[model samples]
Target: MANKSVFATMAGKLLPRTDTRNHEGAQAYSLSPRQALAQLAATGTFNATFYAGAREQLTEVLELAWQVEPEFLAKTAVFAFERGYMKDMPALLLAVLSCLHGDEFGRAFPRIVRNGRMLRNFVQVMRSGATGRKSLGTRPKRFVQAWLEQASDVEIMRAAVGNEPSLADVIKMVHPKPTSAARAALYGYLIGKPHDVLALPELVKAFEAFKRDPSLPVPAVPFQMLTALPLTREHWVAIAETAGWQMLRQNLNSFARNGVFEVEGFAERLARRLRNPDEIRRARVFPYQLMVAFTTADAAVPKVVKEALQDAMDVALANVPAIDGRIVVCPDVSGSMSSPVTGHRQSATSKVRCIDVAALVAAAFLRANRTARVLPFEQAVVEIDLNPRDAVMTNAARLAAIGGGGTNCSAPLERLAQEQAKVDLVVFVSDNQSWVDATAHAHQGTATMQAWNKVKLSNPQAKLVCIDIQPTTTTQAKGQADILNVGGFSDQVFEVIATMARAETGADHWVEQIEAITV
Candidate 1:
């Protein structure tokens, strides 16, 4: 495991190299937009350089979408846009709009443009396209029609058209006649006119017909239209019943506000969905969701709802593979990590911080590995006891107790070496901004490298995994053979670990293993 160049290989493939330039015979690579977004999302700090770099990268990615993997490009663009951290909305908007009109935009645009503000941008960008040199193409037209069919807001659609005489021709060319009641409503809504009252029965009938076909996509159109209907409690119940439990879980707040929680059998239905393994895995329920539920759920809600959330967390983590040997989970609870995970504005109201994310990652490992030890670190380290059965949020709270100091990345390895602890793996969950003790000259290299080498003497097969939560200008610790660098929290980390455990050779093979599970 210690004989491969995993970090360099993975970094080369995943990190953008466009930033690299010849600097006096040496290559200097600035952080890519993807990396910048990761840093911003992790630390929630305002960095002008990273912001400008990210804006440039976004434009580059959008223009080159035809040359890149659509899924990867879409994920990068959508994640950055949705994080709402960037101060420059217009640049982000243009980048998002370009991606939407790019090849294979269908895979992501629908999911991203659902936000009202983003949808407005879609209209504005389309208007710009109509008047500008670029023509308003079929793809954008199709997206607008589809979005209108799902969510028919007369004002928004009119705003999209905006008396652009050229747009009327495009709308007519794309949608000449209404094929269904939803389309009829959309056409009527867009033209600033109302459809016949008789269309209501047909819409309901169409919705009911679609509800019976499991092969069909979820009835997003009918669900959205329901908000405007003057329906009885039974009608709302029927709509909820038709949408199924998965949709209901994602919109718990809406259901609660609509008094759907008071509906009989609602709690039982939710509980059953939470316990379903397939649903849990598909939803990818994480600690963030649990924290949100804890912070946002009303006091009047039933206890069963809380229990269901806990059950969902358990089901989500049920499949994590346990480590085979002694493992140490080191979570960096430094002041830097206490910054909000998204943006400064969000920090004022958000309970999630980078430290919380690190703690959650540590808790995940502790829950999976029976013999694992957890050390929360900043300038120093403190041992904390944890039970596998403890809830993830509980573990995070305990880990968050140790905070407010500079990050000394070498402390954990140095401490383990001094104590003669025979550890097989050391997982450090941090942003990797380790400058506190990094300047010290040591036998191997940096302080972290020297300490890691000393620990390796006692445990030659020990592997180091740095779960980098942010982007850094500093280079990471190098290893002879057994070191891995991963960003963010996902199942991808475990896949890399499993590959290394099999003693996989060659950087290409490792890259393939990681990329296979990327999406």
Candidate 2:
């Protein structure tokens, strides 16, 4: 009865949404309360409570998920209750606790473990009495993990991030001068995720703590910016730079047939014995250069409205200190990354739209160097040294390499890691699935594959950033998403890059103040 009331309370808070009317007794049903409420909702008893006896039984809501392995799912609960479920509860716990096999869940859990009291109890229980214990944390209940696992990545991220800690909240919690556990819990919470909403107040406290005392491992540079691709609209949807797709001054067939998209050797000829001015003029006429030039003009916008972007560019530039603080992005030529990344996917339209994001990030990097490289990567990395003097041959190699295959993150990560001079950061754009092994089959449900799989870190010290493009939720209307074969690319890339980026930009570093600039 009490649990039912609790559920009712939660429901009331959750209900009365902007849209649809609230479900009368729905929220209360979540609780495994006493028999009365169910009986009432059902057959209208307890007051003849029969939520189960109702026209539509109270248990109907659980039917869909339980339908997974109908006989097993349906019968198992009863068997567990009547027979020996709690005896095997740990195993069942693992079964239900899906995060052990989840991607972002596993990644965030250990950190959450340190913060949550219930999780701490669960972990302790697992250590003493469980057969299976996962590395991220403990498996106390199958349902707990499974329920958490069923939730998506962003959902988990939001949940893991608690209410943004504010100064007032801390003041309100009157500690009996504070216990050690409470203090550590509070301190860890503050440092766990700086700049995050729930954790921001804690972060601010930590910063004040650090400023007062200089030696407390002044937090590392947070490299989150480089890890996120700037070229794509999704990365920083506010950046108004028009990335791909020319407005059709000329027809595609006509342009391709004539010398439009052609890669001429004007730069080569200019370097050779040729009278290069005209050759440079011809190079200037090439599409890529025209596009790059277009992108830069947009990058120079003033801060106010585009403050975050300008700050990103400023931080990226300041950290790397580019020759002119600009990057020339010749993204992967493993395939037709030569096409504008934000355009249509009709082979011609969507050719390299994905690469556009990479280019933008790289451009930000180059703006630091005053110039950057836009190369192709497939079996190997080919420097796409585009000539500012001559533009025609620029897209030549990229055009030829348009049909790229086999992308190796190891190759790039290795190269970036090996570089003698430390650049501020690195960002790569590709459909990440390319890095996955075809043999990497899913051994269990989506859950199992995520938990146990771990790729060896190639660039141990370097921040290896990757933005794998997946078919957008609206892909059917937009067209086939990029066909890159890297399975678990997004998960893998985000995991590695976020950690590294966080390290690069110290926790003390202000996000907006870090030396990055974005237009």
> What's model 2's overall lDDT?
0.29
Give the TM-score (vs. native) of candidate 2: 0.26
* Residue pairs with backbone overlap in model 1: 2-481, 2-482, 3-481
How many clashes in each candidate? 3, 84
Per-residue alpha-carbon lDDT of model 2 for 106-178, expressed as tens digits? Answer: 3323322332222333344344333244332333243234433343322322333323232222222211122
Distance from true position, residue 172, model 1, in Å?
10
lDDT of each structure? 0.56, 0.29
| Candidate 1 per-residue C-alpha lDDT over 1-519 given as tens digits, one digit per residue, 9 for 90 to 100 | 565533333211122222232111112223334443333322222221211233343344334433445454555444434432222232233334454445535655665666435555555445554224244466666776666456544333333432333334445545645667765755554455676545544434454455565343333343664465555455555666666445655566766767777888876776676567787666555555566665566765567887787777666656555768888889999877885553244224455667877887788777777678988888888767788778776887788767788877888988998998998888888767665664422222455666777788788888887776543332245423576555545444555555555556322222233234322
Lowest summed lDDT across 10 adjacent residues in model 2 is found at 473-482
TM-score of each: 0.65, 0.26
